[model samples]
Target: MTSRDTLAPVFRDVRAVVFDTDGVITDSARVHAAAWKTAFDAHLRAHPPRDPRLRRPFDVRDDYLRHVDGKSRLDGAAAFLRARGLDTPEETVRAVAADKERLFTERLRAHGVDAYPGTVRLVRTLRRAGIPRAAASASRHAGELLARAGVLDLFDVLVDGGEAARLGLPGKPRPDLFLEAARRLGVPAPRAAVVEDALAGVEAGRRGGFALVIGVDRTGVPDTRQRLLRHGADIVVCDLGELVVRGEPK
Candidate 1:
């Protein structure tokens, strides 16, 4: 191993790396949040909350991270609705999720997302080091997102939401998706490292008994980093580049 790898010793034992697709690999989390906000705001307007505080609009940062990030559309919708004290009937949750999905799809097709340079660099470095890589996400559009960002070829395996659904795998905070990705890469959870931007994603990694859980906190908020740690992240970084060796070439 290189001297740089010694400094970040976690990589030495990691045989495979599983990455979360949205904020961790691509810049599409914000788009998802915006779409969620629009759908939720409309829902709230249509059916006003009884409590004044609950009437407040959805916060992309707080609400998204706490309730929706790393979760499936239906789960996310249900979580956020429950947080706001809204009725969470299955049909109601499905309706809101469908609306958010429509909005997100429209925005995505109109304006494609880009992969983070830092993440790409780290991925390439891992590849050069002969470590397998996987991209896993709760979004059904994960494959399209990666393809649009031109980085779909970087991963050795992709366990997207569609596959998860077909296989009856549960979403993040449950560890099924990441475990599946690692399994496809022929690596056990104990030998794989998981990189994630969502609280639930990191928790899943920890629960799955992964070798390392690196949290990406793009929010730039100190509390966000703390929250990630609290949620089971072994390490928290502002960007994936921080984990990259200084002299390593992309």
Candidate 2:
């Protein structure tokens, strides 16, 4: 390893790497955003009396990036609804979110989600390095996405929306999911690495006290990478391919 590699906390006590799905592994954020838009738009049309006051459907790309990209299903719904002046109860919103998930899954089955070779290569590198790996996501579709991406068996642990709700794990900015990931990997919180693309997720990593938090700037937009750092990421890169996880940087 080079000096830069030696300087990385992931090179020290890191026997594991925990990754976030959606923006991190696959290019399915667009797919999810589209599904969310469809569900929300239809729900609004069907229930005009609900608190939502929007004239048009939520924008899948921009709206999702702002409110729902890496958040839990119900949390995402609550956010968008609130944006439209709705204050539906958390539990009630959760039910709506579940319905939205059903729709999103249908879309996934039809179109399929694809993973980045760079991300798969990174996970493979960690596995070859004898380091455990896990996948964390606030989306309930994490399993389907990973399986469709053909990297389901790469992870020894999965802490996602379904599992989080089932286990009462806290969502982003609370760190429960990331913490559980480290525990499942048999790595102490301070010895594991976290890779995410959401501000909430980066905050989760910092709150969990992970060794390092690497943020992905997938949009290639200005200040997007910097926003991740401001949210508490230790390092931010445009892609996973930019970092050397198991060996010297190419």
Candidate 3:
């Protein structure tokens, strides 16, 4: 039960914690990015842009981080298309989004995502410490993903895309979903900590007035850690393992 001295300074007063799903808890961000690349590349190939500069395929890193990550399916589709200078009609956007959804679902079912061991360790520690935890995500497949990864039971509450739609909550960067999750845990926003990997999610947590915003940088991508800071992450860690309790094995 010995807590990490580094984390003690930040999480000591935290009453609850909310986590973002994809890159934060599970290794599903790459799956989603791959699906987006497939769908966007297909669309671009079929309708070659008039400008040669826009002829390149989707970038799983730059494009994903800037436009799609932490966004709703339709929003992500529209954002990426808009970035390519395409003002497509509603049907076209929906079609592209649907294609991505299908591809992601197929990959997820075929090759399920696994929970990050560091995240799992922290979750277990939180549970033992009597801290309530909630997992919130913009993906409709969040529940299925968590169940598949065998981490569904780790959370005291889950506020995912399906639930967001039912409640008509606004997507990330707006703070609705995270707020709802904190509410369900019976914790005030200012007393809860938010853990996220995406820029939008970090911004949302900041906007939600959470006590602490933890940014997770799995790979230390170029400027990613800095971007997270710019988006309002109070602290940044390359791995949740950095926050593990002192008595725990690294």
Candidate 4:
């Protein structure tokens, strides 16, 4: 059994901490938002606003925050179009999503994903202290991103969308993917910690009853933190590296 005494602060019996990939570890949320906007705008522009262009195609800030983020590509595509009251064909939406993914992928091949230095430092601290760690992401490309970041070897377990779908694991806002990672890492739900930035991911952590749910408010906004708390994060931090103490051990 895990000992509460050792992991009782912001974390519980959590021997291994699980994190979301895109926003938590990497600085890719903005990239994703830009890609989504480019894809959705072209599609919506052609259709035009129902009310004489009263509204622009899509507001990346509000629209990304509301419908597309942290969701599966296909789901996101369908959702954005639905909100615009312009029902696009399934094939059309899928193609749009694929194009968006390609945009992201092209950017990746050119510049590649990079993990936050703070995240890297914190991971090292945890590893040095003998606390196992894992990662989970809604992206099927999570593995590829991690590889490009040169940190794929760090996590003991990884659960990405590709594996989740194959295993019949539910997506975010449901605890399945997080719980599945916990299972693979040999940790019980009550003894694990989950770290995420996405609203859906935080909600999933809440549903799973993880020992601790740490929300990363990278956007540095009160509303963002509030949203994370609404989904039930135990603690929210603007920076993950701040969690590391120079000479402390978990």
Tell me each candidate's RMSD, in Å, in order. Answer: 2.5, 4.0, 2.3, 4.3
Q: Which stretches of candidate 1 lie over 4 Å from their true place?
A: 1-7, 248-250
lDDT of 2 at 47: 61
Q: Each candidate's TM vs. the true structure?
A: 0.96, 0.84, 0.95, 0.89
Number of the top-ranking candidate, with lDDT as the measure: 1
Please say which candidate is ahead in lDDT: 1 or 2.
Answer: 1
Q: Name the runs in model 4 displaced over 4 angstroms.
A: 1-8, 51-54, 248-250
Report the lDDT tens digits of candidate 3 across residue range 80-133: 898888877999999999999999999998999999998998888888878999
For model 2, state the Cα shift of residue 175 in Å: 0.4
lDDT of each: 0.93, 0.80, 0.92, 0.80
- 3 or 4, greater by TM-score: 3
Judge candidate 2 at residue 93 and give its lDDT.
Answer: 89
Best of the candidates, TM-score: 1
What is the per-residue lDDT of model 1 for residues 7-46, given as tens digits with 9 covering 90 to 100? 2566888999999999999999999999999999999999
lDDT tens per residue, model 2, 25-90: 888887777778887887677666443346567886567767776788877888887777666797
Where does model 3 exceed 4 Å of error?
A: 1-8, 248-250
lDDT of 3: 0.92
